[model samples]
Target chain A: MSVTDELLANNAEYAASFTGPLPLPPAKHVAVLACMDARLNVYGVLGLEEGDAHVIRNAGGVVTEDEIRSLAISQRLLGTTEIILIHHTDCGMLTFTDDEFRTSIRRDTGVKPAWSSEAFPDVEDDVRQSLARIRTSPFIPHRDSVRGFVFDVATGKLNEVR
Target chain B: MSVTDELLANNAEYAASFTGPLPLPPAKHVAVLACMDARLNVYGVLGLEEGDAHVIRNAGGVVTEDEIRSLAISQRLLGTTEIILIHHTDCGMLTFTDDEFRTSIRRDTGVKPAWSSEAFPDVEDDVRQSLARIRTSPFIPHRDSVRGFVFDVATGKLNEVR
Candidate 1:
């Protein structure tokens, strides 16, 4: 079976005991933007249960335009106010650059993507950058309620960037 | 204390028993793109452990340029092959349109967002559209391994979106 099939099977088991119909707005009125790294459990680490917060993740947790778009919707449409930007140590983003990755993909697949990978050298710096992006965005409603952190993959500790 | 501060406190408790240095490459060779809704536990539903799979999330799990950028990296740099596009029921994205939201945000914050909210009325159709985007993107490798599903928030069940 494909991995999707396996996950579907797993979901069947989970759904057997499922308790849901949670409210549309998160209970805590918070939104988390974090790296897509499999090691970081954004909810478990943050002590958030189901229906507590919205978790938006991508390659380095960088606050790109798309992230801002989501945040705007979260704040304006769904009532989420606070924003947390979480990057992590040992991120795959730290291992490569946009130009280098673009070159590699072009070489392998003969396609040069117009979008940047948004890689960074330091996780903390990247977190700070993301924080600034949210704080400065005119579309985000709760700019003053933003925070940033770098999660250590080895220890699972989150170091505040500010 | 702020919600973020509470999360930081929880992180401290979690870090006390932290496991170390999971490999950068996902062990399952898979990636899941899902909605940022708080009710859906992407990892738990998929039975994914730490370092098992890359999970990319956004407002609606819609495939955008940035999502493609992240997926390209997941496939090209980190050895992930399969992709799963999962959208869920009761999504806030079902509530509004690009023009309506843009107008609302403009009236509230006096700034019109240049990006689309990527909202849709039907979650299953949105999942199919995301799957098609991934399949058609030249930047994404292993497009044939892509699948789509609509996760039922109340039931915790995933209905395949053929």
Candidate 2:
């Protein structure tokens, strides 16, 4: 079986014991923007149960137009008032640069990407940058509790980026 | 304490038993795109362990330029070969049209959002739409095992979007 099939089998088991159809809005009234890193399981890290908070993720957990769009909808429609941002150590994004990645993709695919790869030299700086993006945005209504953290991959601890 | 502080407390417990850093690349060689719904815990739904797969999420699990950027980075930089697309039942995306959402944001903020809100009328159709996005994109290298599904929120079951 393909790995997809294996995961599907796992899903069958998950669904069997699943108790869901929770209310539409997040119970905790928070939204989390985190890296798409396989290791940073947002649910586990935050001790969140199902239906707790909106979790938005991307390549570097960097804020972009798309992320702003997600956050706007999250708070405006869903009523999430707090935001948590998580970036981690040993990130693949730290391994490359935007110019290098865009150049490589152009050479391989003949189409240069217009978007910034959002590769950052420093994780904490990027976290602060992401926080700024949310705080200054007019679309997002709530910015009172926006916080950023750099999670230690080795220890799984979140150190606030203050 | 605020909810963020509460989650920080949870993180202390998580880190107490936390193990050392895993490798940068996903061990499962898979990438999952799903909605930013709180109820659809991607890890629990797919029985995914940390470091198993890359999880990208947004408002609708819809494919956009940023998602294309993420998938490219995942397939090219990392070694993930398979892609899974997940949209769920009773999705907030189905509640409004893109035009309506855009208009509301424009009226509220006095500036129109250039990005599409990506609201869809149907869930399964949107799943197929997201799947076709990956299949047709030239940037993503490995598209052999791309699949799409709709998690039935009421049943906690994932129904494959055929």
Candidate 3:
């Protein structure tokens, strides 16, 4: 089995034992955008339970189209009013230049990666650029509150970067 | 101090201890959309380090607008190509129905949640609903791979649900 497969199976085994669902806190329904890095234990660090906050994760801890659509629905339908964006330290997404990544893809697959960049060539601008994208998105409810942060994987903590 | 303040301080201290960036793996940059359940550990289950995958989180692992904007930049600038949507068992966002959530907001904040079924509904369909959103999102590159899973908070296992 692949590493992902092994991981998934192990997770299922563990989950089967939870007998009952964990207790959830009465927090203001919150929507958080965070990175998917395995090192970040968001629940433990945030002192949250299963039902406290809604979390959305993607590459580079950056948001994507589906995320926006969901967030729209979350605010419109779900009880989430707060938006917390969490990026993390030692992030893999920040490690490579676009050219380097493309080259790796070519070397591995014998074909170049098939994505485009309206603002590539400028590798250093990713953080600010991603932040801008979220802040200005039209799909976000105009009346909702939104905030961003950077989480450090090694430390298990959060930093308010936005 | 507030829990958030404490975590923020911990994050800063942890970040200061890093000598330099950690090594990044050559794996295809994977983006994960996961729920914000405190019991779930993305790092422990996935065996990921400080820098591995990109994680975007929201309530019920549902996608939203802000998430989409971030994802667009991730695809456009960050090196992400695959998406992993993780919804865990015993999610809190599921506890309250749309009316309950909206009622809670009204009682606490004195404002009604916006967006109606005409354009947006209060209750999200489910993990299946979330998966469909990812599959049809326009921002995701047509060639990039997107997969969805359900993470069991009790077991730390992720299963492909879509």
Candidate 4:
């Protein structure tokens, strides 16, 4: 079976004991934007249960127009007020640069992507960049509690970036 | 204390027992794009552990340019092959129209967003839409195993969107 099939089988087991249909709005009124790193389980890291917070993630956990869009909807429509941003050590985005990645894609696909690859040399700097993007975006109304962090891979500890 | 602080305390407990520093690439060779809904716990639902799959999420779980960017990096740089698109039942995206959302934002912020809100009336249709977005993208290398599903909030089951 494909790994997808294996996960589907796992889902059957998950559904058997599940009782949900939680309230529409997050009980904690928070949203988290984190990297799409396979190792960083946002729910576990935050001790989140169902109906707790809106979890938004991407390649570098970097803020793009899309992330701002997600955060605007999350805060405006869903009532989440606080925001948390997470980037982690040993991320794939750190391995390459925007120019090299785009050029490689261009050579392979014959159509170069116009978008920025959003790769970063430093994780904390990017986390601060994400925080700044959210703060500067006029779309997101709640900015008081916006914070950023870098998750240590080996220790699994989140260190806040001031 | 803020909810962010409470979550930070939780992170401490998570760190206490955490044993990680897993390999950077996903072990299961799949990427899951799902809604950022608070109730849909992608890890628990899929029985995924750390390092299993790349979980990418947004407000609607809809594919846009950023998703295309992320998928290109995932396939080209990280080696994930299969794609899973998940849109859950009773998602916040269905509660408002794009025009309504943009108009409300314009009223509040004095500026309108150029991006689409990506709201849809039907969950399965949006799942299909997300699937199509990935299938048609020339940037994403693998499309053969791309699948979409609507996760049932009440039953905790993922119903395939065929």
Cα error, residue B134 of model 4, in Å, equals 0.6
lDDT of 3 by residue, A35-100 (tens): 555455455445554456555665555555555645655665555666666666666566556576
Name the 10 consecutive residues with the lowest summed lDDT in model 2 chain A: A15-24
Angstrom error of the Cα, residue A143, model 1: value is 1.5
Q: What is the Å distance of residue B150 in model 3 from its true position?
A: 2.3
Give the distance in Å from residue A2's predicted Cα in candidate 4 to where it truly belongs. Answer: 0.7
Record all residue pairs in model 1 with backbone atoms less than 3 Å apart, i.e. clashing.
none
The Cα error of candidate 4 at residue A48, in Å, is: 0.6
TM-score (all chains, Cα) for each model: 0.97, 0.99, 0.57, 0.99
Q: Per-candidate DockQ versus the true complex?
A: 0.82, 0.88, 0.24, 0.91
Q: Residue A94 of candidate 3: its Cα lDDT?
A: 60
- List lDDT for all candidates, in order: 0.87, 0.93, 0.55, 0.94
lDDT of 2 at A78: 93
Off by over 4 Å in 3: A1-21, A26-162, B16-19, B22-27, B107-110, B116-125, B142-144
lDDT of 1: 0.87
TM-score, predicted candidate 2 vs. hidden true structure: 0.99
lDDT string, candidate 2, B65-134, tens digits: 8999899999999999999999999899998888998899889989889889999999999999898888
Q: What would the per-residue lDDT of candidate 4 be over residues A77-155, giving only the tens digit for each residue?
A: 8899999999999889889999999999889989899899999999889998999998999999999999999999999
lDDT for each residue of candidate 2 in A1-162, tens digit (9 for 90 to 100) = 888999999999998998878998999999999999999999999999999999999999989999999999999899999999999999889999999999999999899988899999999999999999999998999999999999888999999999
In candidate 4, what are the lDDT values of residues B65-105, reduced to their tens digit? 99998888899999999998999998999989999999999
By DockQ, is 2 or 3 better? 2
Candidate 1 C-alpha lDDT tens digits along A1-162 = 887788778888888988987888999999999999989888778988889999999999999999999898888878887888888888888888889999888898787878787988878778878888888888887877788888888898988887
